[model samples]
Target: MRTSIATVCLSGTLEEKMRACAAAGFDGIEIFEQDLIVSPHSPEEIRGLAAELDLSLDLFQPFRDFEGVTEELLLENLYRAEAKFALMNRLGIDTMLVCSNVATATVDDDDVAASQLRRMGEVAAGYGIRLAYEALAWGKYVNDFEHAQRIVDLADHPNVGTCLDSFHILSRGADPAGIEKIPAEKIFFVQLADAPELSLDVLSWSRHYRVFPGEGAFDLTGFMTHLVRSGYNGPVSLEVFNDVFRQTAEERTAVDAMRSLIWLEERTSVALADHGGAPGNDGGFPAYPMELATLPAVAQPTGFNFAEVKAGDSGAVEELLFQLGLHCEGRHRTKPVQLWSAGGARVIINQQQARGLAPAVSALGLDVQDPLAAASRAVQLKAQPVSRRSQADEAVLQAVSAPDSTEIFLCEATGDGTVAWAEEFGSDGVVEGEPLITHIDHINLSQPWQHFDEAVLFYESTLSLVPRASQEVPSPMGLVRSQVMCSSDGAVRLALNIAPMGLEQPHGGADYPQHVAFACRDVVALARQARQRGLDFLPVPANYYEDLQARFRLGDDMLDVLQSLNLLYDRDEDGEFLHFYTATVGNVFFEVVERRARYDGYGAPNAPVRLASQYQRARSGRRDG
Candidate 1:
């Protein structure tokens, strides 16, 4: 099916929107009336420009409030629509979308609406144009698509048919199964949009909160499945009304829109095939008849490559690493960088003079099946590619920058992946790895509020990771939204936490919290070893240990061991998790965790206690001053 987008969905001038849509590989465009009214280009010039861009002018919209009115008002609306029909001819657009009346409707009779719409259709037909009547969810009289369908059926003109918008149907909680009941020929055009389930006025929600498919809570896979099964194979166009998209870069937003359509089409096809019978039939469904290209199947990530830390004050960061029991393997042969290792976990400390002293996590290295294929998929999903200069023998890694400006490096999954880069490090002798730490358990990244949803969609669509239902945890300051994305095998786990709106910190300070948790075979022994290295564990209140004993009814020996080590413990039905945190090193921190008996959580119940402890420590230092 052809892909198209509405001009209102993007920012910039009409010409800019056209260029962006064409560059993003859209087949056509729905020319919104407001976009044309505000443009400098005449209708003929717009038509010529679209032709040069190889884009079809799919539809001209919208002719509104043209039905269900008094006789005089109805005649006035018809005359107004006739003017638009003439404009569509000049713009070389055959189809016009006339939305059901939202206001100024005096008549409630279907016959009255049918008569008015039929007159408008006649006017459109005289100009060799078509009319697609849509039911807006907030329409005064005809809010349901079924009601609008009845009016169109009554009008019964060749140029008159129904326009189906997924948002209109789904936002009202209307069953989309009725779409299959409508004849394929009567389905003149389809508009697609996805939205979060928000409790607000329908008009407000539709205008301010609509997102692209796969980015929100809507069931777009099922929605598109209904459309495909109905044999309504027109351009599957996006008509988003998002405040963020309007302010974002037009080119970027356009690319993101196209990616959503591609992902939606493939998912719809898969859903149809899974049904296992005749297409659109209630029984086992067959493959969808529409043709769409499928992306390469993403292989689950096996492990992490390396976690990179960049600090203007590299010495402080290096000291913290030593306290965490990571040995400094060696310095890079050419760059001012040091490599730290503990069993399977590796950290690169970059102290280039050009970088600032504010401590931050600059990059994440992912171990994947095919680094090139992963990067290709990211490109297809509109992630920005990043390149770095390297020497002749240096290993090349695929990298991209996420929306939050975090860099991700893709490296080979197994066998000599990081070892190949050892030639760049100066050390010749083998560096002994730490015995306690096994691998990276998980990485937690704090995101700004505005970019949270975009980040979620990026990880899901690009890396093929699944997102768990988001949870809001109460924090000392406000509620923090935490979303986890992980692979099927639990190899790559990322926790994306978002600060509540208006609480975003300035860049370069403690703008966001970032932490790397290292898996350990034995937390008790590792904590003892780490303490011997002069590690200052984040203090846990004495009351916490007392409560832990009371809550779990642990024996005296276990409670004594946990208290002595400053460890936090949590138990669920499946298993237990024992973990401890190091004092904050600028905005970054470190964690050592041991998961027992299929424990998958990150000890969320302990977060408030941790935050309070950190706060107390800061307050103590200020009082000492």
Candidate 2:
């Protein structure tokens, strides 16, 4: 899990990016082709600067669209690759990021792609250079790790190994388990990045929206774990190409990039230990006990306040809450909001005007020490939850609504006093629905482009989230970008996705929703509570449920109940995601998930079904839509 960042991850000239990487504590740099060929900075100058700054040129990327071509073109591409290799040697760099063909490729001809790639490797071998061949998600052919690995295996050139990019591995929905079986030596490099969890044609979004790891919806930790298990001991570098990253100050971007690497290092170390140790190896790399690396980062959340419900007819919703043992707490002085209390949590129901449809979460009333103080800090860092939010009649506070808004209102509300309001919202008998949604786990948001990095910094510098380093999503999900801004201690998390510029335009899946995932204590118990709450949900089908039971050996009738509720579930060797849905509130609907031990995925396996369901609902014009 040692860290390195591609120079392209920074915003400025090659020199500026290098200086930023050095200042941010990165160990190595991946030089982008355009940065090198177009810049006034020569290979010798880059080499000199790297030496002075104590940085390694981890990789030289990307020899593009090289495979699946005629010999004439292959020869031309070979010469170009050789020239770059020679330059890398001058700069003391050893690796190259060779991409599978894009324009000159045809899936019908694997031989051409492989032959061209093999020839390029042969040329690089003479330069003593290692080429990390990779599948571009949208490549005419060779668009995934497994496919690229086949090409690499066919080539059988030690200098030609594949680059395992988390973004590429994940966006294509490649089976991560294969990573553990890849010959460690064939794994030439690792490109790490994260993105907002979205269902789209993968190509357009990856390039423009990628953000640091733990920031987006991708399961980067799982990818890295599989990498280590496969015996990969190479430099795990960052290769992000985001428009937002390009606009920021070089130093800040570098610091942000280093933070992502450090964060990934810590996570990978733990994930490896969690999965059985490397058959003989430490089965892990970054877990190498270091002093500064282990220091604490984010703050632990002080728990939550309630699950909200606002209804045009409060009668049904109110009955549901009461049936679930939730009781009334107090009323909002300035708004038409009322509070419900249950077991140390408070859920607010804003019926003030009954603006739209049924009850959805109105606001998240978090307990902070000083509202004014936090507000001041937020201003300094330019990180407020969202601006121009719906405000109450009172001038003292504000929380405007957005497409997907999670209003964090800090006030004299909590007073840092003991957490109040338990009996009301707590389980009266077995409160409601599937109980998949326990406490507020994390919030999912879609940010406009060019501002994603700015939002990350806001959360990192103000709300106590250390933004993961930036990385790009390979094609199909091409160019989509995102990052996770989690609470210091990992209690509270927010995932921000970089929506394509024309988000309002038509694309396949459901439009990005501002949805929140709830984490439960005992999913079984919560499911029972949901049963009592009159929730309208469909259980997982018998086939899926039966398959889950057989695969995980889960005891009890939990599977049957989940099936009966029309819920969705998939369990991995690590953890499982039990998902269920209800009516939509405009474009987004609530997703209640039950995560077993070590489950950190944002429910990707279950995405197709969810998206299809939303798409169907949109066609019918459902409620709150």
Candidate 3:
């Protein structure tokens, strides 16, 4: 859909930004004026480079505060704009983004603004350039897009039109339905950005906290739907001003920007299809001038098949699993891996490639309706495909690498909940016991600071998982930003956490802890059995139990059992959640949870206590060592 990005959205030199954009398959780029002013290459040289890279220099921006001024300032602004127009001609760019007068606007009269804009338009037309006038959210008098459009109409110049920016419109809570009323031809350019809902000033929010579409709280799908309905066929470009994006690698940020656009396009198409753009006909909607490509549609994963942990020495992990009531169902015939199961929950212990690395979650196996199609969609979204070694008799699972370098294996879902690959783990027979754990409830993965947002977009776009609003949980290290991504159903929950600042290593390879939680029918019973088996439970402080009693007013018997078992308890309007954690084995740990009467939360209210306990345990361990 003619994707484009602004040079201001990425890190590195202008040349590096252009190269990264081209490599990421953007059709064009809007050159931010500051990037040009700082470039060693002249405008002509930059134009040549864009041609050599087969990239279009779509627009030069941003000419600001040009209208709504006095006669003397108007003449001075015109002189300044004329110089930019000549430069645009040299750079082979036909359009310039003129932001609404945020500063130096002595006159707030519409006629004065329109007259000044018309005069500037005449100067731009002389150089064969168009002006895409945009409203700034913090503009002095021209903050609203409708206000800017009215001025554009009054100007009555062919070279002047409106540049609709999603951030400007949506951030101000302006209704985008007005866009359809404006003539499509007058919609000269469009810039897209998504941001979290914040209570801060609009300028501060737009300048620093803008995130890629699907990674933030904005209703961009609705925004894009309205834009598409408006029939504006201009390049849908991203113009994000994020502190994080500006510091990340240009290549990585460019790819992330392109992925966001691709996801936005797919989502917009689906929204349009839902709103009367059905198959076999355009279904009462006007044909879109810009074609939006749909990806291979995939359903959300049904459930987690297995969670794989890699450890150099698997003894501690093996013993911990045994204490938790999971038995070694079988060992891989030709690999240094073993499969442990308790009912439908499975954990794979793989030591084949662990080397001397600490224990960590290396891969996740998800049950999907169509593994091949799911893998195909993930690969199309720029996920690197992972090819695992398998013999002819072994099942060949479709796999891809997540942004955090975790392997995601898309396994075929079975009606009977049996995996064919499990057959490869040949052994005598299933262990005999009343299964304590029923299945994998949820998994928590730690993400690097830089890749946290990228990982969110990756899972949302590639796996069709929807992200819940993020929350910050206090830990001994710092505040941990945690967001949950899950299927529409209660199944398949993934909790992604931005590790507390100092705990993570570079490139997300920190020894930051992660855990796999298993669902049990009765967590109290499970905790009792685990204690009998000598499991080292992560101790809950006495103060936590006192607070729990004060909050819930539970009876003495229930509270005593919970405190004795070191179990954490929480209750919502829906039901109760009781869970307990195992002591950490390297960077990995386990959790057993009992969800009562449709309780769907992850016990988020108790996260701070758990984090404090784990931190205390680690510190004590260090002291003992």
Candidate 4:
């Protein structure tokens, strides 16, 4: 399978887009006409440059509004298509994409459309080119792929064939199973794109909101499976027009585009293998069997091995950890780092060695069944491997850099990295009491506006984590979008947060506060103990308890107990949740949570209260860590 991407999906000049695409290992490219028209390089020069970079100029696109037109307008359209055909010949490209008419169509008959397309195909043949007719979701007459294929059949010309676009077909609820009925030779090309499920105008949605394959809600695996089962093995290309991709860095956008395609291929192959073939539909797709390359299975994260925080001044951070029932176990053998452990939760504090590096989460360690297999899967999904200096005696943990610039260390579940490294801390394991805080419940990660979707796809593809639908969170400042990703067996959890569009730096250069939530059997006991240690908890307002009383209808005894302990309360159809927070420790904080009766949520209804308290602290002249 040859991989291809359109030039319009990236940001930069045509030359820069080409260089990024080639560097990302794409084998072919679809040159949008506007990109060519605005280029400083001539047609021949661009052609030579593509050859030098080992890329095939697969398709020159988008000859639009040519079919289903008046006879006089048909003549005018033919004359216009001739000029584009000449340009394609000069650029050493053979295929041109002809979209169904969205405007200027006085005739709406399929016979009229077919006759016009046949004439266009004859003219294209004169220039040694082929016409791949595509149906726009909002086309006046041919708005469906079946209708487009019918017209292609009526045309009965050698050079006129139909193009299949996943967005156009899937967005309008068109059935893709009919693709297997069409002959392979007539399926000229395929353009793949995915979009979120939205209620909007089709034209505007296709032009502005199209995302790469794994980033959206489309069933691309089913779509691609049907197409490949039909015996069409041409270049699978991407034609996305996203507002975010057009403004981001060209190299990053190109790499993301390529990664999405790679992920799609692997996912579709796995789906095929699992189902034992295509869904049976009258020799529909089961006729053609697909064999795809396989990689190691992805291992779900077992538990958090450790959470590392880096700061210039480590004294205050250590005091805060100690206050939360975590005692310093020991120091690293070769580095200036200390380990703090509770019941099963571990925290690492590393003194900053690099100047200007803010105090924040720099790395995370996750326990997995097979560390090497997990690393191999990550590499196949296009995650960048991170290299860290290590002594010969220390275990070399497999690591990768996430899109948020945090190193993800994968350690063996049973031994070695987590247990063996404890000896290097240079202390025997002895601590106070079976601590109230037991294990990590979840971690909240803040993402920039542009990197949010990419980060979602990265976590979903690289770690086999499942993404829940995004929800709007009300904040004192504005609405924040939050999405949760977790393992199936309820072991690993991540909450990804993205600020409103105009407020990327929502807190005036304040880093998005990263908080670690620990699970506890008795959160009240943990809160009382923390208060005794002189921990400054984020103060919740009195009005919050009143609202909670009305929402849950709890007795006065339970309500007074919650208010006294400074705990937030929430309840769903399933169960109840009680959680409390600590003050910000250099843009990092801690939360102790007790989940009852299978409560799965993170108490999102109480977020406004927390935000209000944090803002109040900032207004009271508190400094950011």
Whole-model Cα lDDT per candidate?
0.84, 0.64, 0.90, 0.85
lDDT of 2 by residue, 1-625 (tens): 4568987777889998888888777788888888887789778898999999998888988888788777777788788788788888898888988887778654457666666677777888888999888888887767888988888888877788888888888888888999877888898899988877776677766777788875577888788767766767778888887777888788867766665666565566556556654223453533322222332332333444444555455555454444344566656544566665444445566676675454444465444555566555444332334443244433354222222344655443453445433322233244443432335676666665644654564455444565654444322232445577666556557777775444323232344545555565555555566676766542233565566677777765866666666667776778877666655553334556678777766665555455455545555554443
Candidate 3 Cα outliers beyond 4 Å, as residue runs: 278-285, 503-509, 622-625
Give candidate 1 regions above 4 Å deviation. 275-289, 352-354, 415-419, 426-434, 501-510, 542-550, 554-565, 612-625
Worst 10 residues of 2 by lDDT: 288-297
Which candidate, 1 or 4, would have the higher TM-score against the true structure?
4
Of the two candidates 2 and 3, the one with more favorable TM-score, higher being better, is 3
Once fitted onto the true fold, the runs of candidate 4 whose alpha carbons sit more than 4 angstroms away are 278-291, 415-418, 501-510
Better of 3 and 4 by lDDT: 3
Q: 28-74, model 4: which lDDT tens digit per residue?
A: 89999999999989999999999999999999999999988878888
Candidate 1 backbone overlaps, count:
5
Supply candidate 4's per-residue lDDT for 198.
90
Q: What TM-score does model 1 achieve against the real structure?
A: 0.90
What TM-score does structure 3 among the candidates reach? 0.96
| Cα distance off (Å), candidate 1, residue 36 | 3.3
Model 2 error, position 89 (Å): 1.8
Candidate order by lDDT, decreasing, is 3, 4, 1, 2
lDDT of 2 at 395: 33
